[model samples]
Target chain A: MTLQIAGGLLIIAATTLIGWDFSARGARRVRDLTELKKSLILLKSQIDYSIYTLPQAFSHISPRVAAPFDEFYAKLAKDVEGGADAASAWVSAVHSLKNSNLDKTDLENFAILGMSLGAMDSGVQINSIDMVITNIDDSLKRLLAENPKNSRMYRGLGIVAGLLITIVLI
Target chain B: MDITVVFQIAAVGILVAVLNQVLKGAGRDDQATMTTLAGLIVVLFWIISYVSDLFGTVQSLFQL
Candidate 1:
C-alpha cells in the first residue's frame, strides 16, 4: 500500500508537470513573439537615427532584448563579424537556434528580416521591418486564439490522466 | 476490500468535477472533458472489484 501510494504521487507529479510544460510552450511562444516585436522596433529606431550597420545595431540591441532572440541576434552579429553576409548569417542563426518556441512561419518571417537587410536603402529596410512586424501580428492573433485553449486543456488532462493511471495501476 | 476505496473514489469524482468546471470557466473545454473522463474511468476502476463481488453474491442468492 505504501509503495502504491508513492507510485501514485509520482505519477501525479510527473504528469502534472508534463502538462504544465505543454501549456508553457504556448506562453513561451507568445513571449518570444512580443519580444521579437519589441526588438525589431528598437532595431528600426536605431537604424533610422544613426549610421550603424546591421552588426553594430544588432549587437547594441541584443543586450536589451529577451532570450532566444538575444542569443540568436548575438549569433547573427557574430556571424556578420566572421565575414558572413547578412542574409547567410541570419539564415544560419535561425537554423542553428535550439530551444525556441517559434514555428516555421516565424523562422521564415525572421529570414525575411535578414534577406533584405543591407541589400537595399533605408526605405526598403523599414519596409522589411514592417513586413516582419505584420507577420508577427498575424501569428499573435492566431496563437492568442488557440494556445490558451490548448494550454488549459493540457493542464486539466494531465492531472486527470495521472489520477486515472494511478487507479488503474493500483 | 477496503471501504475507504469507495470514499476515495467519491473524493476524486468531486475534485475532478470541480476542476473540470473551473477549467471550463477559464475557457479550457478540452481539459474539462478530459478531467471528466478521467474521473469516470478512475471511479469505475476503483469500484470494479466491489461490483463484481456484488454480481457474484446475487448469482449465488439466485443459485444461478
Candidate 2:
C-alpha cells in the first residue's frame, strides 16, 4: 500500500511539473523578447553615436544585455573579429544559443535581421533594427494578451491531470 | 470486481469535465472536445473487461 501511494505521488508530481513547464514557456518567451528589444535599441544607439565598427559595437553592448543575449552578442563580436562576415557571424551566434526561451519565429526573425546588419549602410542597418523592434513589440502585445488565460488553464489542467492519474493508479 | 474501479471512473469524469471547461475557456474548443473524447475512451478501456464478462454470463444463461 505504501509503495502504491509513493508511486502515485511520483506520477502526479511528474505530470504537474510538465504542465507547469509548458505554461511557463510563454512568460519566458516574453522576457526573452523584451531583452532582445532592449539589446537592439542599445545597438541602434551605438550605431547612431559611435564610429565603432560592428565588432566593437557588439562587444561594447554585449555586457549590457541579459544572459543568453550577452553571450549571443559576445559570440557575434568574436566571430566578426575572427574574420567571419557580419551575416554569417550573426547566424552562427544565433544558432549557437542553447536552451533559449525564444521560439522558432523569434529566432528566424533575428536571423533575417542579420542579413542586413553589416552588408548595408548605417542608415539601412538602423532601419533593420527598427523593423525587428517593431516585430518584437507586436509579439509582446500578443503574448501579454494570451499568457494569463494560458497559465491558469495549464496550471489547473496539470493539477487535475495529476489527480486523475493518481486515482486511476490507486 | 473491485468497487474502486467505479470510484476511479467517477474521479476521471470529474477531472475531465473540469479540464474540458478549462480548455474551452482558453479558446481551445477543439482541445476541449478532444479531452472529452479521450476521457470517454479511458473509461471505456477500464470497464471493457467487465462488459465482456457480463456478456459471457448472459450468453451462458441463455445457452446461446
Candidate 3:
C-alpha cells in the first residue's frame, strides 16, 4: 500500500507540476510582451534624444533592461560591434534565446521591428517601434484575458487526472 | 485478473474526452490538448505494471 501510494504521489506530482507550468506560461508570455514593448519604447527615446547609433543604443539599454531580453540586446550590441547589421544581429540573438516566454508571433513582431530599424530615419524607426509595441499590446491583452481560466483548468485537470490514476492503480 | 482495470481505463478515457471537448468549446485549445495528454499519461502509468504482468504470464505459458 505504501508503494502504491508513493508511486501514485510521484506521478501526480510530476504531471501536476507540468500542468502548473502550462498555467503560468500565459502570464509569463504576457509579461515578456509588455517588457519588450517598454524596451523598444526606451530605445526609440534613446534615438530621439541621445542621438545614439544602433550599437550604442543597444549597449546602453542592454545593461539597464531585464533578462533574458537584456542578454538578447547585449548580444545584438556585440554582433553589431562585430560588423553585422542590426536586423541579422537581432535575428541571431533571438535564435539564441534559451528561456524566452515570447512565442512565434511575438518573435515575428520583434523580427519585423528589427528589420525596419537602424537604417531608417529616426521618424520611420520610431514608427516601426510603435507599431511593434501595439502588436505586443494586443497579444499581451489577449493572453492576460485568457490566463486565469487557462491556469485553473490546467491545475484542476492535473489533480483530477492524478487522482483517477491513483484510484485505478491502487 | 478481473476486468475492472479495463473498465476503469475506459471510464477515464470517456471522462477525459468529455473534458477535452468542454475546454475546447470554451475556446481554450491549448489547455484542452494538455488535459488530454495528461489523461493519457496518467492512464498509461496506471496500467503499465498490469501490462508487464500480462506479458510475463504470456511468456510463462508459451515457455519462451
Candidate 4:
C-alpha cells in the first residue's frame, strides 16, 4: 500500500537523520582529541626549549636573584606533575608562579593566555598554545631590545615554534 | 495543542541533551556546544511554524 510505503520511508529517514547526527558528533570529538594530543606534545617540546634557555638568562642576573629564579623554576617543575612535555610543564609552572610572589596582574595575564591556549574558538586563527608562545617570544624580544643582556632569553624561541610547526604539519 | 506534537518536541529536547552530554564527555566541548545550539534552533523552527498556523486560525476567528 502507498500509505505503508510512505510510513516506511519516513521511519528510514528519521533513523538515518539520527544516525548521521550521532556520527557527526563522534567524528568531531575524535578530531578534537587528536588535535589536543598534538598540541600537548608541541607545548611540551616548546617548554623544554624555554627551560633550557632560562638557565643562560638566570646566569646573567646577580647571584642574589638567582635564588628566587631557582625557587621559581623548582616550584614550576614540581607543579606540572611530570607532564613529560614543555607546554604542560609551562602551564604547571605558571600556576605555581601565580600562587607565589609574582605580581597579581602578571599572574592573571599569564593565566588568561594559558586558558586561551586550550580554548576552541572556530574563528580563532592561531591555537591558544601558539598564541601564548608568540606572546612570550614577543615579550622577550621587547625586553632584549631595551637591554641587550637579555638577548639570550629569545635564542631558542624560534626553534620551539619551528618544532611545533613541524609537529602540526606531521 | 495536539498531545502527539508535544511528545515529539519533548523527545527532540531529550535527544539533544543526550547528544550534547556525549559529545562533551568525548572532549569535543566546542562541537558539543554547537550541537546543542543547532538542535535548539531546529526545534524552535519546527515549533514556530505550528504556532504561526495556530495564531493565523485564531486571528481569523477573532477578526483581529
Evaluate every candidate with DockQ and list the scores: 0.18, 0.88, 0.18, 0.01
Candidate 1, residue A133: Cα displacement in angstroms equals 0.7
Which has the better DockQ: candidate 2, or candidate 4?
A: 2
Residue-level lDDT tens digits of model 4 in A24-107: 443333333333334333434443444323223223221323333445445544443343343455466556554343344434
Error of 2 at A136 (Å): 0.5
Candidate 4: Cα lDDT at A73: 47
Recovered share of real interface contacts in candidate 4: 0.00
Clash pairs, model 4 backbone = A43-A87, A44-A85, A44-A86, A44-A87, A117-A128, A117-A129
Taken in order, the candidates have interface RMSDs of: 3.1, 0.7, 2.8, 19.6
TM-score of chain A of each: 0.87, 0.94, 0.92, 0.28
Per-residue lDDT over A87-112 for candidate 2, one digit per residue giving the tens place of the 0 to 100 score: 99998888976479998889888889
Off by over 4 Å in 4: A1-170
True contacts kept of 3: 0.09
Instruction: For residues A1-170, write the lDDT of model 1, one tens digit per residue.
Output: 89989999999999999999988898899988999899989889878887688899989988999888888888888889888898878888888754588878788888777788878887899889988998899999999998867788778767876876776567
Segments in model 2 whose C-alpha atoms lie over 4 Å from true places: none
What is the alpha-carbon lDDT for the whole of candidate 3?
Answer: 0.82
Name model 3 segments beyond 4 Å from true.
A165-170, B1-64
User: How close to the true structure is residue A128 of candidate 2, measured as C-alpha lDDT?
Assistant: 94
Score residue B37 of candidate 3 by CA lDDT. 94
Q: Tell me, what's the RMSD of every candidate?
A: 4.5, 1.5, 6.2, 21.4
Of 3 and 4, which scores higher on lDDT?
3
Q: lDDT, candidate 4, residue B44?
A: 85
Worst 10 residues of 4 chain A by lDDT: A148-157
Best by lDDT: 2
**lDDT by residue for model 3 (A1-170), tens:** 78988999998898788889888888888778777888898899899999999899999999878878798889988999999988778888877764698888788778887787778899999889889888888887788877888888777667666766666666
